[model samples]
Target: MSTSVADYLLDRLRAWRVDQVFGYPGDGINGIIGAFGRADNDPKFIQSRHEEMSAFEAVGYAKFSGNLGVCLATSGPGAIHLLNGLYDAKLDHVPILAIVGQTDRSAMGGSYQQEVDLHSLFKDVASDYVHTVTVPEQLPNVLDRAIRTALSRKAPTALIIPNDVQELKYSPPGHEFKMVPSSLDLTWPQVIPDDTAVRRAAEVLNAGEKVAILVGQGARSASVEVQQVAERLGAGVAKALLGKDVLSDEIPYVTGSIGLLGTRPTYEMMRDCDTLLTVGSSFPYSQFLPALDQARAVQIDNDASLIGMRYPYEVNVVGDAAPTLQALLPLLDERADKSWQADIESKVARWWETMDSEAHVDADPINPMRLFSEASPRLPDDAIVIADSGSAADWYARLLRFRGHMRGSLSGTLASMGPGVPYAIGAKFAASDRPVIVFEGDGAMQMNGLAELITIARYWQEWTDPRLVIAVLHNNDLNQVTWELRAMGGSPTFIESQALPNVDYAGFARSLGLEALTVIVPDELGLAWDKALSADRPTVLDVHCDPNVPPIPPHATFEQASNAAQALLRGDAEAWGVVKQGVKTKVREIWPGSSS
Candidate 1:
């Protein structure tokens, strides 16, 4: 009746306050599965439909909860399936620990079933730290270090346990030679940049009449400080996609988002700024930033490696966003002239008006922008929004407004698909009392979202506040790639590659006992959101949207415009619709008050 390695591992996770593990079972981890049964699910084993989804759910949990996310998977194919999601966590800099089962030790070097080399497989994705536990004594130290490394580095880590080792009697690392003992407690230090660096950054900010501030997810805890700094410098703040909710969109001086899926005001601010102060963001698109000689820039980030990257900076301050900003604020001088602030506010106001006009534009069926626009005002103050990569991200970025305690995220760095529904599921587990919403394209839904709905149905009733809504843009096309081909490649829509098979997303939701609605027109979007948000359980809104609606960039280059024109001229499958929708959507920016 002694504790097995599997039992001790679960106990250790519980000791670390890990209450749930998202995973799918396989024979490779039969010993661990038996331990879960014996432990009576104290640290609940939340089974995902697939191993990839499990990793994604853990990432989502980590992101929203601001804690360590742990995922489990069987070895071989199960381990391979987890790479994409693990890469998502790694690239996004989320803290996740992946515990994967390996083949039995007796079969080592024998090429047995499910005996792939896991260490090599995970070395790249979990390069921060990846280790295998060969003996019962090695379990505690390896598991503890994996958790500590994932949290400290803010990256994915891995621990591989062989089937034979998992069933062996548990034993602790003693005071014997060659034994490495570990501790559970870890206190994060408050990192603040030296006063000299802060002063130099302040001087750069003080000299410029036109200051531009960019914030990323690293600024999440420093929203107040970011605002104070922006106000002091008379700057307009722009958000990286990962930092969308760092500051409220309701702030007059805050530009919506930066880069391709960004607003015109943000693009113009970066283009015209004389001083650039980047806080906790590594927005990769250098083209969207100020020209090399145009501005003096300063960047503050905790990670020294990412500080001077993306853009050259006059001063790089290595520290946490909140404390660094706090240090810099005292040295900053408040600008008496409010002209730059006034101009930014004016542009921000006009941009919202343009978004409204674009949302109301007529289309073949539903305008995709209308779904997010209508949902924005109706979202709960504490709701968490998750968007999948693709066309849905376009609307989510430009149209939706996040304020109050509301939070939102996507696969920002990796830009992967099929994590929308799984992320939502994980968010619910992270904050069971808060409502969760997901914006997904039909292509993503078909890829993995539909199956995750069954996972939703299996656990929705357990939630204290059961309000999870999934809005699927049923455009019947791989819309994002379709637009990319026209804009980037100067190629007409390749029907075979762009078109998607029609699926009854709403029907599938209803079949799983969840409330479902299908909206074929724009007017129904508002009511659909209202119902879904108030539903006692998870709901799906399958809105048929126009695939030809172009996701035009805020500042589309002449080359991009020319390429798109060439695509239509070459006889795109929906050339006429594309032309009509593109013109209608773009005109709203020129004449915000015009109805036609």
Candidate 2:
């Protein structure tokens, strides 16, 4: 009995516990597609509407499950389509493996039909590792190495299998590839450093009276340790967007996100802090960081390359966040001064009050913020929320509150749109028992695959548990980009380019056999949410929202203010209205006698 190279590859995947492979079929790689049919129930093959969606779904799987996500594509254009999604995973530091089929080995360099130079094409995207299997003997070794590299580096890896090689009979190597089990450990051990580094970090942290702690996605598992350190030092906690779910709003001194889509309290904490401790996040926006002259910093990260790279730090603690915090706990002195923490809490309280008021602002078209404020509290205890890029992401970052075992993530780093729906589709399968909800913009839905509603419907045919919901912010424009233009001192004359034609998203979903609802008023929101949650199948809620609402940055510059004035002079009333609202909100936030 002999096994095909495809069989050996699939076997290695099963051994690595890859239960799902997302992709589409094409002419260049029919052999592996045949193997998929023979794979039976061991590893399910999910067919996506497009190759790009397949890769994005793989990224979603890796992000949500903390495991290596796998996707397959045929040669040439098919393999090229995976780049955008692969870059999404690469930039976000999630582990994902891309298996691409190639034209026959005999077709090299002669411009054969559908042939591509995959090796050079994937080099930059899969900088961590990329290899092509030239022979049957190389099949198992190449597949194993690709997976290991993706896991160890927390990045994307590519394996190119030529069409001819996939159908060849597999032969046992005369000598087996060396296996170093310890080197390939996937347990994610919390690597701690020697006492000297911890002591140095503790010294810097203990010296400052006004300490602030900023957490990122990498510190998600260290929630308890993070809270303990913040409590002992009486420090204020602020989160990066990726770490929004790291600490809930229940923590008194915890300010929300920090940056353009951030809260005022977080901006104030970052600006006023004398000492800063950053955990596991390499947040790229340097403007939001505290000034070097004002603050001394201690940075904790497992990747030494990232330590002190974003800011000037007095101590670089190269270790896992949880154990490093645990080791540094004893070296800190308890600060008796409670003034800094108290001030931050007061600001945070007021910030929340302003947020509540803004969420309910009266407008002809429903305000988008109201959906998050009113619907978030009603979500299932174990809901997995995914937000698309654009205004939906801006609102979700600031307005949605995560509590009690709930988890959430967006297309961080790349900030790419169109992944919201596919991510939710992937998450629903990854956490089958938990409910999955998506907040998507109308532009993003049209850009990605609105037809993917068919994919969800296809999968739902096999499952009895109803567990997917999509909430579409049905504003007929790319509102986020429009705001960015206005903030950057540009005229809104070209706003017409970002506008989208009115499409009935709920009707489209209903056509696919999924339950659907459309609402135009704030009062209909709750019942629509209720119906979506209780339905026995996938559901979509299309809520019309005012596109004039601006995603105001935490701080605005003089030039930006001038830009808004210029637009208003040019008869751009929408820009004038949004900027007016922004100014009004800022006044309320800073005025001494104003309520939250």
Whole-model Cα lDDT of every candidate shown, in order: 0.94, 0.84
Q: Model 2, range 1-596, lDDT digits (tens) per residue? A: 56788877787788889999989888777888878777774578888999999999998888888888999999999999999899999998989999999988888788998888998999999988899988777776677789988998899999999988998997745544653222223565667877899999898998898999999998998999998999889899988888888888778899988888888889999998999999989988878889978898999999987788878888998898888999988888887988899999998888777776777665547878888878877888788899999999888888887777888898888999899988877777677778889999999989884878889989975554676889999988888887776767566646568778999999999999899999998988888898899988989999999877666765767888778667666766476567656655566445624543
Error of 1 at 595 (Å): 1.9
Clashing pairs in 1: none
Where does candidate 2 stray beyond 4 Å? 176-188, 461-465, 573-596
Worst 10 residues of 2 by lDDT: 176-185
Using TM-score, give the best candidate's number: 1
TM-score of each: 0.99, 0.96
Q: Judge candidate 2 at residue 321 and give its lDDT.
A: 87
Q: Candidate 1: where are CA atoms >4 Å away?
A: none
Look at candidate 2 and give me any clashing residue pairs: none
In lDDT terms, which candidate is top?
1
